[model samples]
Target: MKQDQDNCDFIIQAGHDIYYTHKNVLSAGCDYFEAMLKYDTKESREGKVVFKDVDSECVKNCIDFIYSGEIEIPNEKMNDLLYAAIMMQLEDVKQAVSDILKRSITVENYFSTRKVADIYGLDAVSTRCRVFFSKNLMKISMQPGFGNIEKTDILNFVKSEKSGLYEEAKLTLSLRWVENNRKNEEHLHKCLEVIKFDKMSPAFLEHLLESNLIISNDFGLYKLFNGHLLKASKRLGKAKGEIDNRDFIILFDADTDCIRSLDPIAEKVEKFHDEKFKHLRDFGTISLDSYIYVPCENKSVHRLDCRSKNSKWEKMKDMICDHGEFPRSVSWSGLIFVIGGSCHKATNDVETFTYSLNQWSQLQNKPTAICDASLVSLDDSIYCIGGIGQDGVEVSSFCRFIPFSAEWVDLEPMRYPVSDMGVVAVDQKIFVLGGCSGGIEVNYVSCYDVISAQWTSLSSMIACRSFVSAHHMGNWIYAVAYGKVSNVIEKYDFSKDKWIIVKPEVDQCFTIYESTFVKL
Candidate 1:
């Protein structure tokens, strides 16, 4: 026994043996002790446990068990090792044994066994295990207790069978916490907590009504149950005021041949939002040949008017300096900046028309001339993205126009070149949606980040459209009409990151050339 101990110590000191064994062990079971002893042997024990027979291999194995509390086992010998670890109640060894089994198990089989492993408090082992366990898991529709789980997570959970959740996660996840877990009757009774309603969906309002938590006295007006009518009524109203006293200007393309009245259109808008229209009585409209600006009293929109076609020509020449035609896509920064359009029979000349002192003045030319592109004003700067060029080819280059310095700087291009696309500014971010690229209508939505100077693709819209018109209202971006004739209006909510299909209350026959939204 003394010679055997010396041999074991010699193997450990040689670094070949990395484990150790204990002497005078507890008499829990001989099977465990025998397995532990075998675990300590580097060679096949052959059911022998005598000190005289223990060679260098046995000394190495004993040293391995002493230091690491683990013995490397072959694939074929894992089952026996697991059984021994379980019998010995060695949690760390059992976990190691489970890990070995998991590494070999197929993804499909791993899922099924993971649950069994989890139930036994072996979550650490089970978590590292991945299996196609979802296939065998039964799918059940259970309303998620709406206690603050993220919508994306809920949606993913509901779509997977791993959880016995429902497929309506998109619908239920957007609800408030009080509405989700209705079992807490006391919490539900605290309904008078008059919170400001920033986003109000028709479906959400309907859900509240169906749940008996709210009642509507009139269409589009909602009141919470056991709450004051005044507070509920105020919360449900839309259009607060005329954007304070600041001059709110609207820019629109009047499509040369279209016959439309700016005031009646404004009045019609007021009728749809009766509660908010009361404050718009002081608003005015300025109509140009094909462009109109609301609160027409704004001096910026008036300065661009050229009086006659020849005067417009002289104005164009004086403003552009290169004697080019007007650009189809225009953006306002106190003055109008025009880029590549039909110049001298489809010429590419980027020019700026300054509105200060009521005169057209030229600015720095664009790096590349583009037409039918989407233009947006964000943070006192203008961005031009994706359009057809003078060569009748589509381009995706992005350019910025600085008003104060009168300079043009090139920026990173878009992922796709889209012409005749609708662009809208929402929350200081520009969204370019639905346009003709590669001679085909595209439904891809791209968002440009001013801060990061990067472009990210968003969820595609329901329909493919080009020449679309987009308007931003609060957290929603409403896109309406495209192609030959479309009455479809799609509303995209950034908060929910979901699209809502809505029918505009206005007449369907009227073609909307340019519509402005005023949050009254």
Candidate 2:
């Protein structure tokens, strides 16, 4: 083969039969290939060589780069390409890769990149990774992948002089790490040694000692923790003035299937992916005993544990019988009440599900058949709002069911005939949002006082829409419609007695929706 050889050459195979060539163009640019071709080696003489270890995709890209002086390294594959370039001693590709990696360091992947760079002797890239980690350890430690990182790698950073962290954050992060990785209990002490307990506040150290993490078979480590706690607890009082963790625990039917939560401070929406129940078309949801109970289609009820670390939506026993479509529900004294919501002739059916017994029973029916109405429970009674009857007449009457007396107590009805109304309970008062009346959307907002047995008309919502979901947080009421520009999420202020648009509303979605407020 000559300098300008026009002959088939080396084959680089990977993952079965995938192969690429190291031709004249590659030999000129790559020192390894150049050496093989120049020294009268077997590859030079035979005009055919095979690299069994070369990655097929990577070698193909290298060949393209050697010939065209251009190649792309995707973010996910940059490390692989860097390794290939260094092995082949391709100066240009190696330099290009190192520069991009050094400049593109992120908290999420800096530790991983640092590990790889250290092995490859990429000092500049390694330095950037170390710098990023040291500068942002507090924030980086809170990242999603931090708890899953290997203990050895984290210890390596902790041992570094450049790791500019005080012992306070280290204590918190270590506890969080163990909380997230309970399976890694064997590595607890090894990880805890990195946190400087001597520098932590006495109150914080006492809190740390109170944590059940010290309950280990390693008696020596346990004694050492208690030794620190004995001295710390004697010197300090109960911890105070820490960051306030009070938060709203929101539970709402996002769609017909899944439930969602809204964090006012975090301003984030988290969906209960496992809680989705297909064909769910009713607005029946209640929070009781730290679980969210929802009624779905096919007469099936599902529950999601609000207090569980690993919560899942589980199907409960079907109702004793169908309360019919759109049956309203409320939870009180460990019992769930499902009532009202039907088509054709209105039916006066009421079903109650007992949480402790895991059984369903019939409750006293409403004074009259109520369909498409709303139910809200306050104390020992369940209040049923307006609905339409089989005679094609809108019901202006409202009633409350007293569980203790096992009797129906009629309450003053809304000023206007209402159906498909949005009802939410706040304190001793119940507020109803906009709904449809006589097949037409109405924007009438009404509030009923339970103690006074009175109905008070408040400010109306921004739009007239039926099938609305309302959530109560503190003194605010959030109303979201399932029909029409559902994008507008409105909030009702009890103090101001007015409705305020929450700006950028929730995403548009249909299906019977429900909402509950959780204050933490």
Candidate 3:
């Protein structure tokens, strides 16, 4: 066999044999049908002619079609070429013939082309052929057989100018089908499979409260799909022992500046929750004085002892580095880790004040300089959420600090960049709320799922707020004192997933900046 580079022609040489290629021996155009008889034995012609001889020009055309895998047949010869290509299993030639038929088919020839493509098992070509014949093709196209078109092919056709079938095709495909093709389809399905019931049954609402899916807004209501209203209700009527006992700790910024200023706001907190605290005296600024202190300013975290009367607040004998800024955001385990704050122009350095050693020590530095970011402890790790960086630039990305290893790992950035946001860890998930760095204040809430390493958008708060503080109690997360000198308080119910308004009894305006919460 001799192959032609530029044309679909092959020259075959057999010893003392001359025959022409054709589809069948008796085909009308195959004049070279007798050529095969000269080379074959008499017995070969006795049964049936599998091959036939055609006109010389037609033979050359077919040969060229076979070699090149493409042939531009005129409108009149299109049917003949298609039949020949299909018989010879010339896939490319068959496709080319289909393309021609698709572009030139009229009502008169539509059925014919459809029948030919269907017989040849060319589904794509058959669809195109059927579309040409039927005026209401979209209505019939969804009927079983057409559902198998490759998604990529459908998308491509929709993108093409010649194909005005996007709307029709889109109607046939459901959102579920589109979702099924996603790379994270299994994960999405798993999330949807878990049913959350509103009425209390065998499952506890606390389980839903623990879910990262529940969101609470500024209005103090937990929110689910379509803003399902959630209200605070004591666990009753079912398995009462399953309810867990957890206390609420309100964080207040009690730095020397806030305390010494003789602000009426500090007086109000002491008066309101006096019964809940064992000791209310200023514990001095633990963070700023030790880790985030400036050269001359006295910034410290006041330790408000909340334990029982017999239990005294143990001083983690930790000494501040000489001239080092006091720690702003501190987390306690074996030691206290303080993140970024203004020491000398807002240092991004991280330091640990070991409760055992009672001395502040330097740890790894953050990738970016930040201050006023919210820090929360979850799964024995400390996470620093949105804050303002150098030049007052707001950042949404977060970094985690591991106490055992003393390493910091970066996590996914938040959907919105904000500073002075309030964050609380509940059920191994991080709930971040109101904060602002630039002129824009954000009320949108977001939750970070630790296991999945993904973020989900939650309902927005009723009021835009900044510099908020959050406290988690039972299955509820409360956001208090957002914005400058505001007494706005909201509670989020994790069970029904809704926010409800709550009144915080406080007199005078105060900003809760870099505050810490301890469960009472």
Q: Which has the greatest TM-score?
A: 2
Residue 149 lDDT, candidate 1, scale 0-100: 27
lDDT (Cα, 0-100) at 174 in candidate 2? 60
TM per candidate comes to 0.40, 0.49, 0.42
The per-prediction CA RMSD against the true structure, in angstroms, equals 20.7, 21.4, 21.7
Model 3 lDDT tens row, 246-266:
233333433322321111222
Q: Clashing residue pairs, candidate 2? A: 249-518
Least accurate 10 contiguous residues by lDDT in model 3: 288-297
Model 3 RMSD in Å is: 21.7
Give per-residue CA lDDT, model 2, range 133-204, as digits (tens): 666654455444566767776666555555555555555456555555666567767767766666544434
**lDDT tens readout by residue for model 1, 1-520:** 2225433322122223233333323212224444545464643243233333223443443334434555666565454455545544555666776776566544324533454465555665565552232221111111122233233433344345444423222222223333444343343232223222323322223334433231333233244422333343355444243122111123232322232222212222212211111122222222222223222111122222211112121122233333222234444422345455432223345544322223343344566655567677664467877877767778788888754344677888899877867788765578988988898988889988877888899988888877666776545777765322234457787877777665433333344444443221
Candidate 2: which stretches are off by over 4 Å?
A: 1-258, 265-267, 272-275, 279-283, 343-345, 483-486, 504-514, 518-520
lDDT of 1 at 9: 25
Give the number of colliding residue pairs in candidate 2. Answer: 1
